[model samples]
Target chain A: MKNIFYITILIFIISSCKKDGAVTNPSSVDQTYTPTPYFIQYPFYWSYYPVPIPTNNPLTVEGIALGRKLFYDPILSQNNTMSCATCHNISFGFTDNGKQFSNGLHGEIGKRNAMPIFNLGWYEKYGEINHRFFWDGGVPDIESQVFGPITNPIEMNENLFNVVSKLKSNPEYPSLFKKAFGKDTITSQLLAFAIAQFERTIISYGSKYDKGILSNFANFTQEEKDGMSIYTDIYKGDCWHCHTISSHFFTDFGFHNNGIQQTFSDSGLARITRDPADMGKFKTPSLRNLVFTAPYMHDGRFKTLEEVVEFYNSQAYLGANKDPFITSDKHEAGLNLSDYEKKSLVTFLKTLSDSSFINNPQFSKQ
Target chain B: MIAIKKSWYILMGFCLVILLYSVSCKKDSTNATPAPNPTPSSQKYSLSINITHFFGDSLFKYNTKFINAANDTIKFNKLAYYFSNLKLTKDDGSVYAPETYFLINFDNSSTAIFQIDNIPQGTYNKFSFFVGVDSLHNHSLAQTGALDPGYGMFWSWNVGYIFNRLKGNFGAANTALTLDVGGDANLMKYDLPTSIVLTSNKVVNLKMDIKEYFQNPYAYSLKTDDSSIHDLSAPGISKLVQNSKDMFSVTSVQ
Candidate 1:
């Protein structure tokens, strides 16, 4: 009886200790801890860049933290007054605060409006005609693209060499660089890589519209759903040709001549490709965050989404080089939607405004 | 007696588990079942290519002197060129090609960071690569990555990617020269498909010398006559025609 009592006590101690003890034995409940946040997790399917990703620059928590800090640091600019966040504000769906153009160092006004960055990783291509980046589409690839604002007198106003030297001067950045990359020294290439990694994480895939399409969602209002129907109609209000809406990234990744202005001094694709026929063409930006990214068009000519719709309705005047898609009609006659249809479209566009992206502490100015 | 029997059973079970574990560990350490041994001496090797520039007999150092049109002396502050589409040919006549491969912006770091993985270890007889944009990336809005815009390699106004950007200043004349060449006027207008082929075959141990290019004076000369600047900001008809003509060359196997 005494032996039995001792055996019972031993078994009790062993089983109770297991609540906090480390054991290799398989259990009914999951013991392994895997905590990937809602924002940073990879999509179900994704593609990589053309020039394959260096194994060293694989995305990681430390790399992203360093990148976020670099992105917000004004030290990237010459005068140390402006950063990428100056133009790409977090509150305004990663765009300037509905401004026509953003102000740079020494208060220099840019010619083109700042573009809202979202789901950049999913884009097979960027810029007009699926070019790399920029309103004029001058730079190719993200690595060289960062050099633009850094070197531009009107933008960052920092010399490329000077910028490198400044980054090296920062005691914090070196450690961050070492954490992200093995080495502590920061190169423009490495800096760009880190920034790209952070930007790639800025996915707007959790919008009501996203959920609607993904889960056959009914979270949105009846008007918003009606607007989406009009927006998706291929022949009618077919905005999908350029602003594609798939279950994943919500863009067709194409350029279009959306007849907004008569004479494009900007000469977007014309500036990049040097083809006369491509005159007045601009990249078709995604309409995912249109509600927050106001002051529409490349030059920020339109103050509101209504004005943008009106311009598209009028099919604003463009000359012989104009795209055949934009008919000569004053407005896109094909739309032929009632006032209610227009209201529904606006409501649906609003559903794309995700509060989570704005309020997420992770992306905020930490 | 029953207690003794129960203790013996537990001890036996524990001993059996420990014995299985030890056997498993030993199996892992030694090649327990040596099945299908890998072929020995089937060699695989790697070769690196370093691209260098030359002006005549000597290396083409950046910020060095060169004569342009009208006998104007000029020196380059920055002299870099783009080369892409590397193809490696082995002695067996097998070719290994890197897809969508290109190299630009001559940094002190790695060059043409493409890997010719799984190449059967053999002596490569020849190395080849295109010196300019391939027909694919040259397509309208049909590119990404290093092929994206704002590299200052594109003519925004003219709607064409500048195939090359050769910038420098004439020292004697105190004039600056900016030469951006890449586009076919024939393609822009009548779609005649006027494209030039600039390819080179260099023996690869581990480096590609562009020195042969600067050695030939007539092949690439700086012009400082009227607009020595030669800035093709926009790919206008004149700019397109002039730049396309100036920025290209072909070299033979070394």
Candidate 2:
């Protein structure tokens, strides 16, 4: 009986000792931790400007993981019912799902269509002019762009200070922040850094067009080939002047007035630059992933790819600040493409879609 | 009984060992702050620039009414500006640049004085500084310290710091007056002559007359002229940038 009593005490002692070890030390919990560096794997064919990662905020495994969680978490919103993924759904090529404008927390409507997010890592210092973010190129870089949606009254509608406090109060976030940034104290700057790191990693380069280019049209359909010719032909589609294919990044990454309207209501790039010459200018969006991202244009005025193709083919307005390419003599009456040609152009755009990018498990919510 | 006591002692010893092992693990996790590199004390001396704001003959304080050369009554509620790339020219023409940026606000007295710890011992006769951030640091989004965007001096939409901001009420009607000056074109540099012998710790006192921003070359009327100037391309911006160069003067050196 005495032996039995001693054995029970020994077991209790061992178990109790394990529990003591599990108790977290408050001081040690706040200690500085070095995070592992995360290197992005660019495709061998892609030769562009180096990714504009800020020297102060390098990509790290822990930082990216924390950012992914923040991107998906609704804790950033005022009502905690919306997240960045609410508007930038990964399955929709990181765009709003077939919506003209995204819906905010209080059922408020956004002014512009949510631009799809991809290939943004390459949009930097394209030439003499630095490539900027947003439809109007208002924000200078991706890191600065994170501040816009969070504070905009029609978007997430959350104050930055409140967002920081909310994240700090969460039971799980403090530790995650400590692991990522080496400090438990969360600031808006660090939050921007973390989210920006995750965004730079959301790359897309596995489209059918990419494959066809590599094979020298070996796998391309005859219709797709004809569409490509029309897209490049200045007298036909005339789209390649701005959305150049040779650069791999379809958009010129410059602001231009595409002549969507004769009299400007939005005042696009002019609002940022305060130059009347820049009136009605908007960013030239990438032609990639047309299948997933629809309801096109800055305002999402066109619902289908057919409408977008038709608008550019003949309906582009001849406005005061319209790009000279559209106002040139050859495009005086527009491309005036036939039904078959229009269909071919749309077909060629669809070839740029990459299903593998949307289905990539790394980009999906955990 | 003796055997049972022996086993009890062994179990206690094991429990103690586990406790100590857990403590050591905790100690290993606690990161030590790295020590700063030591510099030779004899070769360098600390220098502090003390700035004081004035409205004409009186001390400048926020929300206090003051008359300008335009003869308009102005009460400033907010006044903040940036100073960067500060360099001191020794009597021999050699320059000693401390390489720092400062954002000073009239509301915050603590920020009015900035110190340079490692100024090589010499006799400095002239000093110069730019009124705005350089083009490179102005455009770079990732910044910390005084240049951090959280300070509310940065324009998030345009991605540049507001070089100087003066917001207040003017005229009898209390009309709103705001002048947020920024842009690479308007970054003005001022070279002021001063005499100082730096062998040890020294303080250089400087005075910035708020009225100087309204006159000297151009007279700005708050009632008739543009009361709000946020854009760099505004008509009266060049006048304001021109007037900023004459605002600062060395009052004393000790």
Candidate 3:
């Protein structure tokens, strides 16, 4: 009789416990978590430029924290193996360290070269079409563009619905989502918004280039100074036309054909617009953090800055859709840069690398 | 021998569960179903938008041959676009904005039907909606459903949405034309003025005929003419987009 009674009690106990643990819902009153606004402070020197903070997604402490976690979480990947940081390493100015192409889930290589994410908050509309993010200029906003890699077949290869379902199932993510977005429920919009908020806070103002060139706080070396002259002066390098050194971001943020090919393997902007005239046109990447991010260009063709400079000096093949400004009065293969001039230009590019920005703790994975 | 298996242990387990539940799952305020002054349990308004494709009153069957301005015989692979910020207008001049965004893709039968639920049953006169996302949601990050950039409708480089995308085969094998339109955020928006009386039947069948893209006020004849076919995009784009003004209409009010 005692054993029968015990079995009945055990049955009741297990049955009652099963339903109790299943409730994941947060009631109406607990849904409200106050978001503390985190203001992004800009350097006084860059006041002239517009910060690309979206009016809808202002930065918050909780949001930035959640974004940081998500940015580093491999849970965003299809196989739960790759995170955004897998390619965009914080040590390498948020670019893949010396990788020609980033590795994705199941050993799939990325389609394009990984871009460095720094001072993206200040990247703005330049020239005719105001394009931002990616070499092809496919998506417009940084937040919206976050969908690119996660769903990209060669990248993370995970869908937004799956990402949501996965994040919702995790015990910790729901509360993190609540702290950032004011509810326990998770959504893709909030995921992108939080990640973007964290990315915007990756400010790179403490570079030696900033102090030595822009602020005149540190003295520039003679080689660095001479290189800076070639970089800025229209007669020598003529690079200032596209990558203007006058701006704090050091990029005009315009798309260019850049005299790279004779026959197009990559249609570049043409693929996006379906306009044949846009063949070989690509967004001009920011020249900052060259020390860490190697194998340059949309395809990461050059292994070093010397190779990139040397290619532009003579080996550049201006295809059918080369930009007009890449040539002066006469059509030439390249800039025909003198050997000394090329070295100086390369030296100047190295000064833009910000070690302080890469080492900052706020950007580090905790 | 275990002496009734100590029911107090089960009681202790229950206490521990309650403690953990209190910490993680807040029911004091959050889980409470805000039942203050609950409304009458009336069934909600069932609003559904049905997309019907046509090639000038002839039903648009996919894979059917059609000639383009570029003189190429073409058949559609897919047609997808966004419909955002749909609002039902009442007689009081107020609007009931839906929390949903619709992406109508004819290739997927599921996408062609958009059923909206939990809407308040009322007498709505007219509905206001946009064919593309506005500037606010367009540039914002990681929007789901219709606005998700993963749908291949977003422009990442320039930060805009490709309001409408048309993909199909061209004249010869291996030749194709992808006409992406509607980044002109200033010009792409269209407002529908059709009257929708939502009194007797909560269901409204909104029909979007693809052939209407060719003409309503503007004839997109440039897209069909063979002589103008050499030009890839410039021939009849403006004509087609301008014709978008008459795309959506109230086909049924039941």
The whole-model lDDT of each prediction reads 0.59, 0.83, 0.72
Indicate the residue-level lDDT of A5 in model 1.
50
lDDT of each residue in A1-366, candidate 2, tens digit only: 657655765575555454345556554455456998998877766755566666788999989999889999999998998899999999999999989999888888988999898878677656214338888777777777787788777888888778888998999999988888898588888888888888889888899998987899788888899899899998898788789788767888888998897789888888777789989999889999989998899999999999998888888899789999988988878889999889999899999999999998878898
> What global local distance difference test value does model 3 have?
0.72
TM-score of each: 0.62, 0.82, 0.69
Model 3 chain B worst lDDT run, 10 consecutive residues: B225-234
Q: Could you tell me which 10 consecutive residues in candidate 3 chain A have the lowest summed lDDT?
A: A20-29
> Model 3, which residues run further than 4 Å from truth?
A1-32, A125-130, A214-218, A274-277, A318-321, A330-337, B1-100, B103-141, B144-203, B206-251
RMSD (CA, angstroms), candidate 2: 10.6
Q: Say which prediction, candidate 2 or candidate 3, comes out ahead on DockQ.
A: 3
Flag the better candidate by TM-score, 2 or 3.
2
**Candidates 1 onward: DockQ, in order:** 0.09, 0.19, 0.21
Full ranking by lDDT: 2, 3, 1
**Index of the highest-DockQ prediction:** 3
Candidate 1 lands at a TM-score of 0.62
lDDT of 2 by residue, B34-86 (tens): 55575543468888989898888898888889999999999999989998888
How do the residues A157-194 of candidate 3 rate in per-residue lDDT, one tens digit apiece?
88878998999999899989888878757778888999
**Tens digits of lDDT, candidate 1, A1-366:** 546755655565455444334334566456543222223564453433232232534666776777788889899888888898988898998899889888778888989988887666545343333365666555444444555666667878776556668888877788778777666467666777777767767766567876676567577787887888877876546666567665344555655677776777778777656577778877667787788888888899888877776566555675646666666342346456677877777787778877788766778779
